[model samples]
Target: MYVQIDLDGPAGTLRVSGHGLPTVELLRSPGAAPDPLVPLGTRDPARLTLTVDGAPARIRPAKGRLSRRSYRVDAIVSGTRYRLVPCSYGESRLTRDGRPLGTLESTGDGRVDADWAPGATPLDQALGTALAAAFGTGAQPWWQTAADLAAELIP
Candidate 1:
């Protein structure tokens, strides 16, 4: 199933729908700076809740200080942990217990794209991207972006 995130204007939040019914609302903190794109420098992270069948999966955002990482959302399902990490080329990686599981990429068409590894599921990847869109805000460069740009234009 595909995940759709609607920019909820009045509520100043995002409505994510997929893997279930009606829609799941991802609410930014009231104190969070409101913007269609959450700023790269901000410490605030969004929140989301998901339910499959009869169980609940919590997507909670956590800001990092030592890593200098802006934020990470941990989606825990039945005690299993998953994390979102902003990677190269405006892409985010979802990791399970420190292992690469999947990736979410933003395309030129203004749509979110997801690519999963061997065993990762789409639902978890979608949830990871939801709170993990900081885009390397507080982290260092991943090198790929720099190399790509340098290769494209040789001055």
Candidate 2:
């Protein structure tokens, strides 16, 4: 199964879809259409677009290296780079400039969980949850979505 997710940014609304839909919860957010002007190329399994932003960004392993556990994600948001590094305990950590911001984890029951560090914002939690769900899989698509959604959270 697949899911589609949408997020709001400082510039304008960003939409993530394709594969074509049903992974993310429509209960959480309704998606917007992607702009045809900017091309995302063909490497990603998911799709995203921001109303007025830089050229398309790429999702790569943190530090440009592979991991034995899972791929820790890294990307630039609004030109600011952010890393979703893995914690020693098996969850992924989203940190900027070495400051802890949030944690995203996979529950054994097929649900992905997101927990914001103290002083985190709603967007942080939402992004973390979306990141967590990017790695999730199951019969239901509620918590399992595409990496494209995770990439758009940058900025």
Clash count list over all predictions: 0, 5
Tens-digit lDDT track for model 2 on 1-155? 23234433222233434352312211111243433311211112243322212344434432212232244555544465556655644477777556788766653223455666787644344444444444321122222333445667878
Best by TM-score: 1
**lDDT value, residue 79 of candidate 2:** 64
Residue 42 alpha-carbon offset, candidate 1, angstroms? 6.7
Cα shift from native, residue 99, model 2 (Å):
1.4
Q: Candidate 1 on 1-155: residue-level lDDT in tens?
A: 66676654334454455764334345544555544444322334343334433466666556543332344556676677777766653676788878888777643222567777887655555555454433222244635445666888986
User: Please, what is the TM-score per model?
Assistant: 0.57, 0.44
The list of candidate 2 runs beyond 4 A from truth reads: 1-58, 62-70, 107-110, 136-155
Cα deviation in Å at residue 76, candidate 2?
A: 1.2
Error of 2 at 58 (Å): 4.4
